[model samples]
Target: MLEPQDHRLRQREYLLQISRAITAQLDLASLLNLVITYAVEMLAGTSGLIAIYDEEGDDLLRIRASSQLPRDIWPAFAPLLALPLADLPRQGVAVLRDVATDTGLNLRQMIALPLALRQSAVGVIYVFRAALNVDFSANDRQLLQDFANQAAIAVSNARLYQGVLREKQRLDAMIEQSADGALIIDSRWRITTFNKMMEQLTGWTRDEAIGRPCAEVLGIHSDQGVNICLTDCPLQRRPPAENPVAEGRITSRDGREIYI
Candidate 1:
């Protein structure tokens, strides 16, 4: 049995280890695996599961990670995790020993912890003790709770990253399909993106036109043959051309000059 001082030291070290592991990688699968693996090893348990609540609750809680749990039987327990268990009891913990005799879960012991982020519960960690006559102490619960909070942060970060990627993809698709010769530039006039229409009109692939200046790509001229790129840059005038339209000459890749 670990003395009070020894338990405190061990808990402190374990918490630090967990923090390092979770922050080392932001991938959701990798984070979940680290969490479950550490929990089972530290608690001296045989198996474990990390279940994350579905954001919309439209889908059941997802088994983000697991160990030694029968893969085929995991779905049978989904109903149990549909509702998240937020806070521990007043003792700051609970224990269900020999629960298999009553509930037939086949688990020798079960300890549930709330994966909390700030004031909200995001998920739960379940560690199973089999063939070990040990019970989790209050210190153990506190340590595990801290571990679960790290899992929650990893989950939230990965979810936010995924949302940002989706938005970028959607915006790119709209820009590519736009009917006009669409190109985006910063305040400095260097092209940021050149769309499908822009590529076709210029005879330059999107890859080739990006980063080139407007004057370099489209050298405009007035009907009087005034070199607009040098002398009559409408974009530089006080009241920039009422309509951002002007006749310009574009040099294609094959050395053909086309007027627009």
Candidate 2:
């Protein structure tokens, strides 16, 4: 058995570790698992569950992650998990009153903490203790609250990252499927994106073209045999408000001169 002071010191160290874990994690699923695992470990609870707010869910709250929660008793816990936000305790901790006596499971004690941000509830974390005699202490509640606050911020950030990633995927798909011979460049005028149409038109594989200078890939030159890309590059002269068109000729990979 550890002294109270030593136990507290260990708890603080564990909390610090969790702080680092949540900050570095961006994947929503992995973050939720981390939250529930840490919550259960910190509280010495038998199981844990994290439910995120979902408007389309039949219960309004969807169980996104669980730790040590038994599959057999999941159906029995539905009513408790589905409790409305208005009915849940807004501050501190409380008993899971929704757990019915007939549920046939030993889990009786619970600490429910709403994952709140800016006074709005984003989700909730539930830690369950199987032993009815062992009650959560005031310190336990406060420690959980502190951990929950960090977890809430992490969850919000992870959601934003996932949303941005999905949007980027959609945009990437649109760019690849576009019919135009599209090529993207960075500030240094290096090729960053070369789509299929560009690959076909320039006779350069995407793998061979990307990261190369656009001027080198296209080899565009005027009819007078002057390299247009090296002198008065059309890309640099394009007006911001109106699109500019400059015709030039390029020598393809097969040594054929193609007009653009």
Candidate 3:
């Protein structure tokens, strides 16, 4: 029998394993596989599963990975694990000592830990044992719960980073497709990004336009005939959402007038 101190040490080791596994990859599939494998090995569970909640349409728990469970069981098990966020416990762990003992239920010796973020349950980490020898103790349940909390934060961050990348790609495509010149200016009025039309119209390449002041690059002049770069520009007067577009005349490097 493992002593209380031994259990604590084992739990610490398991937590470290989980932390290392999560940090090892930004890819969701690799992260899910790591979580399931680590949970089964460290928690002494015969099987492990990770189910991620869909953000759109439904609150279903889509199984990301599993070990040692029948493929058919997933269809039935998904609904049982897909309880609403409000119904789950805020903190602490839950343990079902022997699933086999509960004749009506098809599962045995399991624990469910909510992968929570900002007091919401985003997913579930389930660990199960088919035989009595590898049954989860109260301490094991607590350790697994703590691991789940950390995993949730890691998963959330990964998802957010992925979303940012996708949004960037979409914005880039939109800029390329635009008929008019689309330029992104920084707080200092420097051109951060400009569409292909802007480059072609101004006789400037993307490489030359980036990081240069708009007035210096586009040659916009004020009503007083002063360089706009020397004056407070109107483009910076409003927030991005409020002022996405501006119209002005610019002189090309070749001395041709162009409307932007």
Candidate 4:
């Protein structure tokens, strides 16, 4: 058995380690698993679970992560999961809740904490003890609350990052497979994305075109023989809602003037 002081120090170390691991992990599944696993181990509980509210506003709480709870025992936990959101503790504190004993499960005590960010309850974390008299102390509740706060922040960030990544991938696919030549420029007027069709049109590969000035690559000239990119660049004056099409002559890499 660990000395009381030694156990406290070890709990602190586990919190530090969990904080580091959760923040660095962007994958939601892996982060949730890491959270429940460490939470169960740190609290010395027989089992634990993290239940997250559906983002689609279905008013449903689904088990996103669990540790050591047998597959058969999951149904016994259903009543707890189905508890109304209003019934769960949400004041940034963990509290003891009575677990049903008639379900043939040996669970006796549970410490429940809301995984909240700002004023919204995103989820709940529950740790269970099987011992008859092993009621969770105030210190255990506080420790779990602290850990749940960190886990909430990590979960929220991971969801946001995943949304951004998926959108980026979709936009990239559209740009790469576009029939018309397309390129994206940054605020500094430098090429940031040179799509495949642009390569066929300009005779310059993506690696060679990226970071170069858009005016230098396209070399577009107006009907009046003026270099429009240097004089009347539409990108500078166009309204955000407007998608105007202007025909211009471009000097290709092979010294051929191509009308586009």
Best by TM-score: 2
- Candidate 1 structure quality by residue, lDDT tens digits, 1-260: 66778867876777677677666755787778878877777777788899887888664577888877666767755545654454323222232332344345556666788777767767788887776468877866776777788788888878788899898788788999899877777687778778998887777787777888877776665556566877766667777768765576656667666677
Task: Compute the lDDT of residue 163 as modeled in candidate 1.
Answer: 91
In terms of lDDT, the best-performing candidate is 4
Backbone collisions counted per model: 0, 0, 2, 0
Q: Give stretches of model 3 more than 4 Å off.
A: 1-25, 67-108, 162-179, 185-192, 205-260
TM-score of 1: 0.68
lDDT of every predicted structure (CA atoms): 0.72, 0.76, 0.70, 0.78
Better of 1 and 4 by TM-score: 4
- On the 0 to 100 scale, the lDDT of residue 222 in model 2 is 91
TM-score of candidate 3 to 2 decimals: 0.63
Candidate 1 local Cα displacement, residue 52, angstroms: 1.2
User: Model 1: runs farther than 4 Å from truth?
Assistant: 1-26, 83-106, 184-193, 207-250, 254-260
**lDDT by residue (tens digit), candidate 3, 1-260:** 45768867866776776677667755776666666766776677778788878877377788877767655656656434655434534311232322233323334556677798999877888887667555577867777777678768777878788889899889888997899877777888788888998887887888899999877887666444566545546665545346544345677777777755
Q: Report the alpha-carbon TM-score of model 4 versus the true structure.
A: 0.70
The window of 10 residues in a row where model 1 has the poorest summed lDDT is: 90-99
